[model samples]
Target: MLFKKLYTKSLFRICPKILSISSLRYATAPSSYAETVDLAYSSYESTEDETSVRPPVVILHGLLGSKNNWNSMSKAIHKSTGRKVISIDARNHGDSKHSSQHTYLHMAQDVIKLLKKLEISKVSLLGHSMGGRTAMVLSLLSSDLVSSLIVVDISPAKTSPQIFSMVNLFDAMAAVSLRSGIAMSKARKLADEQLKAVIPDINLRNFLITNLIQTNTGSYSWRVNIPALKENFQQNIASFPSSLKGLQYCGPTLFIGGSLSDYIGKNDLPEIQEYFPLAQLQFVDGAGHWVHSQKPEKFLEIACSFLKDK
Candidate 1:
């Protein structure tokens, strides 16, 4: 589903108010909050049992996924590590604001703003697919805020076929009309049938179609910017910068890829190391591109181990 627009002009949030380091204010909106706005987001703090003294872990979801997609993983990480977890809906996804521009730099800036607003001095980063790319850019742009980096089943590389497939799914979703009050069950059934040829997995089809929101006028539409994402699909799959020449993140870095997927491979290591010298690569057997969702427990085990430094 080509959800929110990549550059809808609703993504930028200007915070002109400068806060003194001594007076770190939590939950204070920036003075420039009045500028162009679209979706808003809130963090879900871990329960007392899952709370920890370590810096919070920020989780970013992939394309067509909101923070909700990380619910299971977030909860598990929290409980296992007792560290606070903040699952973020990167700009155009979930309940967050949508923007016309979906560039990696723009997406990274969104996370920075959110962290500043939350008064978070430092955070551990975890991202999947598109979110993984966003996290990588964030670490490069604002390395101070990041402690460790965990990438799930995605690399800083071009994904041509995957991009085309995503465009097709978005096209299919845009073509469907459920404005006449179709039941969720019926809508899901129809979505499954429509996407069956392209997305054979019933679970993934349902996951993407969940973005369908029933409007007051009874028309079903997606929360994502359809036109923007479909138009900028190529930009989304663009490679990460390989000229880090001297730049690098020394913190512990984990790269988890799917054995059955082409998202990461030996050929990508040079660039990966060039940017993140301490990065470690691992693979989840039998899993595909969506490694986190396909193998939640294994993903959790690796994540918790890293976060706990055990």
Candidate 2:
């Protein structure tokens, strides 16, 4: 819980601009990489590398989230599991390159490319929200490359109508203007005012604003590609592809849902099992959609226990 306490304390250090929230209902496209998306990633190696034998864990963050969001958790996982942990910035998010196309298939391919480029033969994947969908699709397309799949607070099925708050969040972010040379303070103030109407939760607002960065010119800019994401919002919020209907990942899988979150419900199990036949569903008591952040200790226990199983 040390990292959880530290994460909470760091939230108020400086005010920043907001990012998009989870909007989880849409359709998927065919599984083909029309273009290669350059994904950016960071790795955490075990302290005693010579003794480490666990399969590497690759983490994918949610919509509007970057590899940076998983920094603390990645370190913790590596320490506990003795496995190399790699966290990536999906295309158009964080330091990754922007592209005109944004779909689960495309994103899944991006992850595959990164793994291949790193020469990692197999990995255990952990993804949250939109990242969860990407992980599912990737497992279906390349089951050989995935050792285990852990989906956090998201289902393969269509999301509920309430998830559309992300659409409103995106529209609000797009409306904010960050003229060149503006101070970080003023930019954050303006952003807070605009985001307040759409996103009223202080903690959620803090989580989203972490994506805002101060440019070399003193103006604030989002680390995420806002315009591209907004334009391809529908694809980004899509469900696992229907094209993968008959394909099922027989590998060990886990679905961790937040007890207070409706993103993953009882109705979604059939669809989840249809693709992930070995999936085990668990809920984190007293947590919401951001389950890991809300209950880091419990999340870590569940994750490490699952990953360490032989």
Candidate 3:
């Protein structure tokens, strides 16, 4: 129901599928947003008319989140900025194909392949948490592909203690046995109940439970690759690559942090500015790592203002 509500109101009905070791192709493109970029103005009202074609905005969701996480905001952003919006399902999450190797580089390349398949030469990127890191890496690796960037509640430096703490959450989820033949609703309840043993926060459990999907054979399973995530979380996901230290993306970048979240510290500013000298930072009060969802209006206002100039 959580995703259903978001999808009903979202302007985008289809999302790009990312594959590994295979050709990039649309999973199901018929009767969707495949044929037209200029037709995105039906429900969304364009505020500005530009003589030059503006780059499309490609939105990336965080760990354990799908493109639908940003669907609500995508509509508003397209309405405000008058640009095409493309929300993606990163590999191992959502509708994308899963892979054993999940790292920033691998994820960035998946996005690049999708962009190349779509023939998008230049793009504006909006990403959150893990996806934010992917955006930063992509910007640094292919500076010409990215025109502008918006990173929400994440840093380019080493992972914070809060992110490390997520290891326990993943461990707890892995211990849960959805088993076969259980109804999807019952499986969700069981997963939530079991997860509450280690993670007391019902809100967090419910958020994670949205990843549950019913298999074709009347079985329940999580869409995200838990075993792979567990194997690579600490070394790969939790730590930023040192090899990318000296590299930088000089494109216009905006970093938005949540005041209530410890993901971005006061000390990380120098490193961020070093990698992105043209970077700008903004914070929303009473919000956590999911700043865009927590404070949609303010995040949108600030984001739209930044994209307006770019």
Candidate 4:
């Protein structure tokens, strides 16, 4: 039954920009119209006295993920490298303010603003999936602000076919019913039933459902701005910008892929090297798209080594 539903969804495709008003009627209006997003973040600073010598690391999560996802990892990184770690909740995700517009340009700018606000002159950036793409764009747009870059399981070439599956998942989430004052358990049960029909993978479904939160009124809502994300899927998330084609970021860069994930393949190396001339690629065994989460030890080892290297 789930397979049949997924097959039917795969046949339905629509341009993200052409979303009708009815499609987004459930979404609330954005609080502001500013081009720059005011990002919310958490910091992990080293307890040792030598913290000043270690460069700060800024971590960005993927789509539908919040800074809280990186909490443990950030602490681990800080402990290992004795560096300050900042895990940011990108706009429209976690505690950050939602906006009608979401793009890599705006996301990258938001990161810059956060850095300035924190008085960080330069940082080592580590990003996963959508965040990886954001880091790449930011490195190219403002190379001076980034000392090093680590891109996890994502390429800047083009959108992978895997992204389309997310559309179906979002559609399923939007279809779930959640009246005010509904029990959290009941809401989750309802959402899971609807999501299971479209997303068969339990891990993915679990990850997506983390965005579901109980509103003050006791109704279920999503921490992420799903409507904005859905609307900008093709225009932003699904494609790399054409304007950045000729641009290059000549900093030390590492591209980490999961052996089981098709997000990054050998064929992608040329384009990656084209944009990041000093880039090196590596892969973690027995892992998928969520490489860091799946193989935390290996991911952290590689990450700390790369960041520590001069």
Candidate 5:
């Protein structure tokens, strides 16, 4: 399908399809997002306004998360604004393509391919954690495709290496031996035990365990490329390419950080300004790294008001 406007009366309903490839397994969703069927990605579109020509807004989730991760926020945003919203499954995490290598460049390209397939000329972007980095790179890689950008609790500066100690949590979970006949409940219990010390939130623990899937052979395994993620963990926290040195996105951008999260601090503000000179910064009180999920109402308020403003 070429570039065109979608009516509010038509709600996109994607039907799930399972596909097997030599490289990886995929669950494809079919609907109106894009006409192309072979692309390995999933999307949820929610629209409200019938006459408004609001630019498409795409939401990208963090590492180890799928498009479903933004189900709540995407629905909320769609209900609040009559504009189209798309939540995408980034590569290696969700139903998207799973490769042995994970890098910001490759992830950003996956999003770009999705947008191209949708024939989206321009879009507003909101990303969390690793997703935030992808959005930042997207703006640099395909500036014209991005109308506005929102980076949640992340900056271009190199993040502290110590933060990735959490990978041990994944290691611990992988260490748990389970057969194909084992139930998810048992797998959940084992993963919880491994992650209990690191993740205090039961809900978050469950969210991570959702990546664990039952294989066709009845074996339980993680959907994510754990070894690839482990190897690229440092690159995930590393700075952007030097070619992006002088690149500055002048769009209506917002940089949101958590009050309790050290990921984005006053020290990182200058570097952020250097890269995103037009960015507006807001720090959410009583929130941490997961600022948007932690303070949805405030995040929505800020986002809505910003988008509405000329």
Candidate 6:
């Protein structure tokens, strides 16, 4: 399903003129509004078929997650399907270029560019959390490029209300100060200790600490652009963009929800079907929002099954 280009130019909204500035001073809105960044990616080649012309599966990681998080999963998917798997770090996350704009439009465009760079005309997208939303937008706007989609623990509608509380997590992360020469182990422990007041969940803290890196300067720092992510969280992370209202993707799609997660529910079916008429929904029992991590075997089973079918 190689889709023709839906649009040639990035969508841009003109800023209203400032009354006192001039009669009607206006140029195109700043490029930052829809800027695209070169994403960092890791490719896991298929072991079974070096010459298979099948479309590869592209995994998009979630908020605060990097391609590194999916390394094992990528290898597993490739091993299972004998199809190449490529995972990417979205803008402002992981090793991707940092920018002030972290909206779905900008992110989708980034993926489009990355695909073009790799000469991939069609792909299967597997996304988790924030990445799921990005995949949704890309599929909606460019259906031809998507062969199938697997969304993990999220919906196209508004996200869970609990996501808004992430502001405290970002604040807690921002409050930490790792001095130069801090050991990676000590930095993680110290970060965990400092975050205890705001984030009491040990598992959650450990997951977030995965983003922590020991810099060449011998100092520990977060590679993710926290301030940029924080600025876009309340709106971007909490809900899907309205600008994509009328667009729909007609490709095979699967919505995988964790039974214990509120991120996706029956209430979201209508909204999802509106955009993806062929979409299917499945919930992994006993799994939470981070279903893939919490239940790797089930997640992989379901994902591989879906991939095999469509």
Q: Model 5, 50-154: lDDT tens per residue?
A: 224667678888877778778888877766665677888776776766666566666766777777778877888989888898898777656677888988888
Give per-residue lDDT, candidate 6, residue 120. 91
Please report how far candidate 1 places residue 84 from its true position, in Å: 0.7
Winner by TM-score between candidate 4 and candidate 2 = 4
lDDT of 4 by residue, 156-224 (tens): 865678887787877877877777787777777778888898889888888888888997777788889
The better candidate by lDDT, 3 or 6, is 6
Predicted structure with the largest lDDT when compared to the true one = 6
What order do candidates take by lDDT, descending? 6, 4, 2, 3, 1, 5
TM-score of each: 0.81, 0.85, 0.82, 0.86, 0.81, 0.88
Deviation of model 2 at 57, angstroms: 0.2
Error of 2 at 203 (Å): 1.7
- What's each prediction's clash count? 15, 0, 0, 0, 2, 1
lDDT on C-alpha atoms for all candidate structures: 0.70, 0.77, 0.75, 0.79, 0.69, 0.81
Instruction: For model 5, give the 10-residue run with minimal summed lDDT.
Output: 1-10
1 or 3, which is superior by lDDT? 3
Determine which window of 10 residues in candidate 4 has minimal summed lDDT: 1-10
Candidate 3 residue 298 Cα shift, in angstroms, is 0.9
Arranged by TM-score, best first: 6, 4, 2, 3, 1, 5
- Model 3 lDDT, residue 204, Cα: 85
lDDT of 2 by residue, 194-229 (tens): 788878987777777777788787767787777777
- Give model 6's clash tally: 1
